[model samples]
Target chain A: MSDTLRPTDSQSPQPVQPLLARIKRRSFFMYAGATAGATALALAGCSKDETTPSSAATNVSFGTGDASVLNYAYALEQLEAAFYAKVAALTTSPLLAAEVPYFAKLATHEAIHRDFLRTAINRDFGGTIIPDLTPKFDSIDFTKRVKAATDTKLGILDAAKAFEDLGVAAYNGAAKLFKGSVYLGIAGQIVSVEARHAAYVRDLITPGSFATNEGTDVLGFDRQLTPTAVFAIAQTFVEQKLDASTIGQ
Target chain B: MNFFNIIDLLAEADPDVLDRFSSRRAVFNSLGTVAQRAALATSPLFLGALFQKAYAGTASLPTDILNYALTLELLEADFYRQFLAAGQIPAGAAFDAITVIKTHEDAHVAYLHDAVIKAGGTPVTGSSTAGIRFNPSLLPATYADQLKYAQVLEDTGVRAYKGRAAELIGTDLLTPVLQIHSIEARHAAHIRTMRGQQPWVSIGDDLAADANYKAAYTSGVASSTRTTVALGGTTYGIPAFNPAQPSPQESNLQQGAAGTKLALLITTGIGSTTYLPDDAAAAFDEPLQAAEVLDSSRAGGLLA
Candidate 1:
């Protein structure tokens, strides 16, 4: 069965069987090969994606490892989902008719992202998942675009832009921390979409300002923020406190 | 077998393969004693696949990945150069904004080429490389068509970078590639907006007006026909042009191999009174494989 993994049966003679006979002469290659075999067997026996009930916690600690990464993403998604839900639900905001539908779409996307991460965490890590977060939006006006950068209250467009940009930077920085290729692929898929959202919102705020030097580096690389830095900014809008000190450690 | 045998096979297959490995050896060494042990513990099948995928075909080196990216960057940089050379784009802020994008593409081409050389791999600069040159004849003549084609190019570049990102895992190459990936996406949105299209890729964002080249949105490895170009007597086949997913069209709602669909509206309090399929589809963008990106590029006449 182990022979099936061989790159070319015709080229090299099988060395795995002989290595087992002389376990005391364990080399790095032998050790690696043995571990790889065991991990494959272990993974084959388990299904991490099976949906299971998980007890949620109050003060969300992203915990440790990749699960912590997913939970951190989940917490941010929850905040964005809530923010957009509020914006979409508003009946008296001074939004244009076309703008209302646009916000509605944004709300759906953020909700979908939140739910996807929640399901992923629940299925993969089970009880390590964070609880639903309550959002605080008193700093956002949701009525009008902020006239200046110093304004404490952000307009709907300003808030959306901030959230979308934050998400892009967060994902960009976090991709390197992922140990699994699967999670990295998923992050790659999602980060571009977030960038698309950021571009759209940035353009809506200021014409043709998408991908400007301010949002990206002088060489056009997008901004990347570490988890600690991201959560620091993100916590301001969330009613629930988030602890991501253990993430990706 | 022994680790030497596996590496020997890779080196024998491609002379530059060992150099690429050496460049990344430091990263693997720093994975720490425990992680190294875990790497050994992984199944031989898994490790075999990793090596094979990293070295398969003529395009399977870290240098190949960089060259592939350089090819796309060259194509984009040339496209903008032509757009500006034609004296067609209107002046003022829009022009300046486009100049920003154009300069970035130029910078990307330069940086990627330098990185390729620094990594001890030959950069594919469309010079002396057969069928790698930008075919301006394939581009649309009118300004509107120009912007639309630009949108297609930018979006295709976005997916192309994403499709091969996993291949670059555990190296310094990964972050830089992702940085460029997001930048390409930003360009896609900016071009889409300039074309009077939605910032997001909606259901009908297909580039080809003809049905034969319809796989624009959700393309993969087997989506288009493969064609080879000769450089210095060596034949290099452009990666698959069509996205290989079951449905390569942008209208696809299922994401990833698990086929997870976006159904946020089904959740309570989030349902829209008016059902809009495009909005749901547009809310999320799909990923393409390297072959799929090549296929889509050929369908658009960007690839030889």
Candidate 2:
């Protein structure tokens, strides 16, 4: 693996280069900006008072090759890590004292995973890692143990399940794109953990419901969602239009 | 001669270089006669030709794979039933759990077999007259021995199913296969925890205790410790990592080749372990040629 910790300074701040080598860099950026602006305008029009930060307005682009997949994972991890971190920072009612440490540990794990992907892409792919995602959790009520009519409902357990389930399906869906066995093995390891997390969270929702047919299909595999399918669900949490056309680019 | 020397040598080598060497050595060591047969059967570059033939069509549908998969579940069901009937499982909560698990396996077999027939495939039938028994030579002599063996069997089953999930994806049978796979993982986890292992720790967890635990289960000896296995002068050990405190690569096992030479040691004697059972091989799970399952009397051991 490349040295992900010490990202090359030259590649840090430059705006993302379009994947097509023949396209003029300036024209590509202009097109991306226009597309993003249009998307943001449409989003703004839909929710006039929505307080989505301007920083979260960029178009989600996959750079090239495996880095794109990594970024996809990174983005999901960002949503998850952020939610868990918030949960860990703010305690809620009916919080089992023993479960607090577990959530904290999950937060740390997600942070590490997020950083690891960022560093790997920076070091190996020589690209600017996608910026830290700002989640739109304005709707979630972190203060309520149960979902209140007023709150967004994006808590630790809910976020964990969504992220874990999405992560498993994403990896499963994307595993075919990876030509390298090393990548596949790494994916295999990650998905199993994701599956474990899925099981744990499923059990949390309903005890012993972890490995049942209800969540997974008949073959005992986790439900796999196509990129388009997952992005539809994820777009709710993120402010940006994740352009996954270049996913396996 | 020592652990440090081995680590030093391994540390200097790049991952790809090590991977290549491991692959080549695995071919020469394990694929000896079979490799020769495969080579002779096809033109030059037989391996590529073989893969081309194997993955020829998208027609390797989920239903077809599941029909074949039902065979594996049936085999496990038979194995557990025989073990139960032979009074192999110890009398305790463990035994009660094993009985419950056996019933689940039976249910899985029935479900899969029914699905297979529904999908226009033959329902796999195990022999009532031709009983398939565990290798008495490899099994433990006591009740704890039985528990350890069952634990390892279930754990291996869990990994095996998971390892094949990708191939089954996008098939009609994907849901059923995934359902079974998760249950198998759950069963493996429950059995492992019953054997004084952590409930959350997967058998594939590359932790220090994992190796020790695997060794104990395979060998039926509590004194077994985590140790590296030597293959062609290279040693591989399960590295320890806490899931809650994952390292950079701890969350993912670093990728290797599509087919790398990784030895799965199954303890045969008190200390010596062998490879996984022949029936456990991926080739056996696929539809076999006439020569593959020639024994009419031993159909239970082969098909079901």
Q: List, residue by residue over B1-304, the lDDT tens digit for candidate 2.
A: 3323432464343223234434535534544586564554344464445335433432344444554455556556666666677675657655776676777787877787688668765554554344232434343456665666565555445544544455543345544555455466556556555555433442233332454233311211122223222211222222221234222211122222223333222122112223222211210111111111112212212222
lDDT of 2 by residue, A183-237 (tens): 4444554455456556556556655455555533543345666677788887777
Query: Which candidate ranks first by DockQ, i.e. highest?
Result: 1
Please give the distance, in angstroms, between residue A84's alpha carbon in candidate 1 and its true position after superposition.
Answer: 1.2
**Candidate 2 docking category?**
incorrect
lDDT of 1 by residue, B1-304 (tens): 5555666675554334553443446535644596574666355875665566555543456777787788778777777777777777889865776798988888888888898888887777653234355566765677776786678778778777877787776678888888888988999988887776667787665454535345565444443355543332233345444333332355655443321323233133232333356755665566665555555434235753
TM-score of each: 0.73, 0.55
User: Can you tell me which runs of candidate 1 are displaced by over 4 Å?
Assistant: A1-58, B1-59, B127-131, B206-213, B218-248, B256-276, B296-300
Model number with the top lDDT: 1
TM-score of predicted model 1?
Answer: 0.73
| Angstrom error at residue A173, model 1 | 0.7
Model 2: CA > 4 A from native: A1-56, A91-93, A145-155, A215-219, B1-154, B161-199, B202-213, B216-304
